[model samples]
Target: MNDDPRRIHCDRHGAQRPAFVCGHLVSGVGLGFVEPEGPQDEDASDEQAAWCDRCETARLAGGGWTAQSEAAAGITLVCAVCFEASRARNTHWMEGVARGWRHTDAR
Candidate 1:
């Protein structure tokens, strides 16, 4: 109900901030959109990736880190930790919005 940008939730918890892992599976995942360039202008782009605060820690834990599976939706950056936990309690991650995001610029 609140407007906390990072306030993502699990189907079971109602409202929760689950730990996540952002994978750079594809080179640039967060780019929003791109603009064409003129004869003398360079292309312009915008980033829409959700950068996580815990990514720094996960980045430091580099050894155990691995790329997520390639799901039908798109690249899965979030790890199964929270996903599995929610499943254990009979719920899904992102409250059934587990479908991954498609960065427009990735096209």
Candidate 2:
């Protein structure tokens, strides 16, 4: 019943989990959202597609990364290949968050 948005339960232990980002989950850590590539069945507009910030590639074929956020509440489809690449680039940021959390817990 902990009313904290930053805290989540730890699956490994019954301890109050600190707010930390997993690099394996999404690109980098921090509080940013990630939309992994998947499939799309319905007709979507241009804005619904996920654009690669690195390669500037746009997914126009099938399912791709789809994510919704406060700024972009609609579905954003991204290509699988590009999404994976982006994830790799974001791993460093995730590691940083993990390190910061560990340091804070040690105090």
List TM-score per model, in order. Answer: 0.23, 0.23
Clashes of 1: 2
lDDT of 2 by residue, 1-107 (tens): 65764344444433342422223333432233334356544663322122222211222221333342212332222333434444546545656477573335555
Error of 1 at 18 (Å): 3.3
Global fold similarity of model 1 (TM-score): 0.23
**lDDT of all the models against the reference?**
0.34, 0.36
Residue 21 of candidate 2: its Cα lDDT?
Answer: 20
Candidate 2 residue 24 C-alpha distance from true site, Å: 18
Task: List candidate 1 segments past 4 Å from native.
Answer: 21-107
